[model samples]
Target chain A: MATTEAARPIAVATTPHRRTRWRHVLTGSVVPRVILIVSCLVFLAPFYWMVVSALKTNTELAQFPPSLIPGAWAFNNFPDAINYIPFGLYTFNSLVITVGATIGAVLSNTLVAYGFSRIQWPGRNALFYLCVATIFLPYPVILVALFDIFGRLPSFGIQGAKSWVDTFLPLIVPAFFGNPFYIFLMRQFMLGIPKELSDAAKVDGASELQTFWRVILPLTRPAVIVVLILAAVAAWNEFLLPLLYLQSNDKYPLAVGLIFFTSEHDVSYNLLMAASTLIVLPVVIIFLVAQRFFIEGITVGGVKG
Target chain B: MTAAATSVKPRSVGRFRLGTLERRNLKWGLLFISPWAFGFIALGVFPILYTFFLSLTRYTGFRSPTLIGFNNYTTMWNDPDFWKAAYNTLYYTVLAVPIGVVVAMLLAIAMNQKVREVAIYRAIFYLPSILPVFAISFVFVVLLNPGYGLVNLLLTTAGLPSPNWLGDPAYTKLALVMIAQLGAGQWALVFLAGLRGIPIELYESAEIDGAGAFRRFRSITLPLMTPVILYDIIIGLSFGLQVFTSAYILTGGATRGGAGPDNSLLTYVFYLYQQAFQFGSMGYAAALSVVLFLASVILAMAVFRWARGWVFYGGEEA
Candidate 1:
């Protein structure tokens, strides 16, 4: 801030006082526009570097100070990186796994959350508390238990088939069962809705399912979208689950794929950056488009703190 | 004619009484919620039960189970590393949660300072939050790199010695703690929303009473903000305890078997991962997970109970 002022003084002196004040405000404040620009640079530099490095030759990558900008972006790096691994196969695998998991999570979580929120039933609090309690058990503790159960027996009656844990079922199946986090979010959003509407629907002889489908689902679109987005992002970015369950490299998600890529290579920074860039591109695009709802979902999803 | 027409109204198709329809609706509602009911039994109940059962056994992922009740838990009680992981996690929790919350609140206050391009600043801070953990980890790895990294460069230029960040055992956990602060923009935005929800009249009355900024904040804003703070702390603790991606990636995967440099960064989850997946100690891993789960539950319950005294719902009087 002080440096920006020091850099341009004559213009400040010659300009109208209002203009000078405005300049000072934008350029010299705590969160000055300049600071914002620099932070954005910091925020964006890695992705930019990744793109540039992905384009650079192996020779250019090791150069001192690293090329801030590539001389000639080796577009071939994209194909080359993909070729090094079963990139196409992995991409398809990730999409299938992520999509299936997301759909399953949304359906199950929403239904469960609706039950917890609006539907009165026996053992409701105890059941809901049990769901909430599940959030605390970190993946490590459950991994062994889950493996024990799924690893031995055919998962979900897929017996005589290859072991279920080695395949994609375990990754996607839990989502359909609903996650505790998504349930909390759904229930919170449901509270914002007027109960009178549901009552009116009930008075009209609409069954609970009909009301949920025709009314609650439509009204809770924002929450639903946010949940779906979160689920997709989580599933897409998941490493541990796939790492545990997936034996074949072809079954890896992008997170695992990028890691495997780095592990296989001889620490080629440029190639690693390229792969990381590809790994994050879909998430960045999706988030940028849906940022508003995403933020809303988070704030509203949280316990109003 | 209008009165007569208005008075006469009974649809023969429907039962107008409440009791009959109410019972029917209750049954239907339960039926509609059956998917969740089934899920609770299958996904929720069974896994928890299975975990408890597994904890008392000695089953690896590859092997058949053998009963060894309470041995895994008892062994963990004696293990110094378990204590280390707990201490490290608690160290992180103590340092990160309060500091993160305070910084977020301060940042939100700064952001609400009637400035132009608030949205832009908000987005700039938020960028890190949305980035994949690996990307942030990679950038920090470069930024925190000893000699050539930009942070060190700036420190040296300013006539300060640059600390070895990720490499030093002393600083590894601290470095992880610092990295947690970077993506604080998301939390700041959350705080900003919370601050906005606060009615302006509270501030107005405080000002009218000649309460200065600090006093106003102390007397009014802080109390009103307790619920949100409680919320943030609970969420942050759970997430922070499970800190893995940064450590896992930075330490070159779990094949290294633990967090780097004398296990300075070996959080419980990291240790649990090593046991279950890397070492193939499924039973031990399940025990560790169950214990960790119990710990988190205790923390969560503590927060909720503490909140009853401090957190003011809008309708509740102080």
Candidate 2:
């Protein structure tokens, strides 16, 4: 049951408020510049510590007031770290999971967001709010039963548990249905998309799906990339879920696998830091390259929430 | 198009009157969002409800759950380790969230300062937050270790006594709180956005009135940023309460059952994992989850209620 749909609303950016020319508070000066540099360096210290420790010998690491820079850079540390675990295998597993999940999220989020934005339904707004509120469904509570669901896959008994446990399925499968945060972000982004394009397609006798795929999806590349980056970064660095589900080393993602290294060789700070670098490098690169999308996604999606 | 759409109106007889185009939109909307709708129920709603029931009974990966109402709850109430973990978690949340938010906001304001190559500086500052927590945890473990850790080295050089960070239960959580800033980058970005969202006119007018930077910040910026602060607190509360990976990794908890020295670093999630997995007390863990969920819900409600008085909507919806 529904009434005649209203005209599509164009999302307005906040109107610029009138200026009242005021003196600058934080004027660029020697004092502020020095403070800025010092702050940046302080933040960079941890990464420096990681890299420095990674290149140090065990004895060097053990020294009080550990060497700021290693006597000799241990180029072997990265190789050693990888050799210590099935590092390649873990990387592969992490990639498969992150990539698959990103793809799944992109598909699910766009479609669902389109439904909310372009289509009119009696329960659309209510359901969308319901979806958004589910953002707070702490997974810890749900995992108790979710683990049980995975354990017994209907006809398949404990035997299927092998594939379920220690496999990438747990993290990747859920992405096929949109995550609430990404969906919210995508929906907000989609809200700004001019509806005339879709209406014109409708006038041309295009189906809703065609309008979504051809008209909406193409225009929403920025939104898609935003969701993809969010999904990918999250899926990549995720720790607890993988730790809980992955029982074996071979199936472990870097987050889980790296910790396994720490527990086993607890004192090998060199190898530990090297592996830390390895694990962090990809995300750092992704973040740096896609800074705009990531920044916009959080600022817009998060502020509203 | 109007004629064609109108022709399709009479097919479905419904209690409520509907336009033809509206009916089509309803069909397409439902059809398009079915996957998410299915997922919301299967993944979110049903599991939460099931967990609530599961919390009431004893079950350890078994299909059947025998009801023993209030028993699991009472058991957790009487559990010392649970209390220790709860205290540890609260200590962290209280210490970390407010400090983290303030620091993040300050950093945001600092970054918002008009400067050249500010983008690069911003990226560098924000990089740590993007790094995996586990990786960062491991680095901090070595960095904060009393013997060879860089943290102790720096502190000692600064003429401060170095506490055994990970080993001393007294300092384990404090150490985590300090390192929590490593991930404050995301919060800072949000703050920066909030700073940007503040119309420059506010600051300009305040300055025109001879208000100093600090006064301007207090009178205008801080008030406007209350909503963002509310957002930051909510995010911080959730993450702070559920802190696991850093605790688990830094304490060598995977090997040590997630209990740092004297069980000091045992956060709520760490304790939850131990209950369900280590002790084979899945039901007890479920009960723990229920407690955490309820506590988080209550605290969030309180925050939202409190926020109402101060959160300046600035013409936006509350």
Top candidate on TM-score is 2
The per-prediction CA RMSD against the true structure, in angstroms, equals 6.7, 7.5
Q: Indicate which candidate wins on lDDT.
A: 2
Whole-model lDDT per candidate: 0.72, 0.79
- Residues A1-305, candidate 1: write the lDDT tens digits: 12323445665677757775675565345554444556557556555655666778877765544546778777778777777777788888889898999899788877877887766555667867876766654545456667666676565545234668777888877677777778878888887889888767766766678778888889988888888988888788777778778776666777677776556436655566667777788988888888876687667644211
Q: lDDT tens digits, residues B1-318, model 1?
A: 222322345334556443433444456556655776676677656777898888898977665779998999999999998888888788877888888898778777666554567777676667667667776576566556685455666678799988988789888777777677766667878888888877777877676687866897788778878878887888787877778777777776743455888888887778887888778888888888888878887887888898888887777665
Which residue segments of model 2 deviate by more than 4 Å? A1-28, A154-163, A302-305, B1-3, B6-15, B316-318
What docking grade does candidate 1 earn?
acceptable
Q: How well does candidate 2 score on lDDT at residue A280?
A: 83
Instruction: Tell me the docking grade of candidate 2.
Output: acceptable
TM-score of 1: 0.84
lDDT of 2 by residue, B1-318 (tens): 544783465555666877777877888898888879989888877777877888888887756878899899898889899899999999999999899888888777777765656686677777777677777788888888788787787788899999999988889999889778776766778888778777766766666688876798889889988988998888778778888888888788567554888889888988888888777777888889888889888988999999989988887783
Interface RMSD of each: 6.7, 7.8
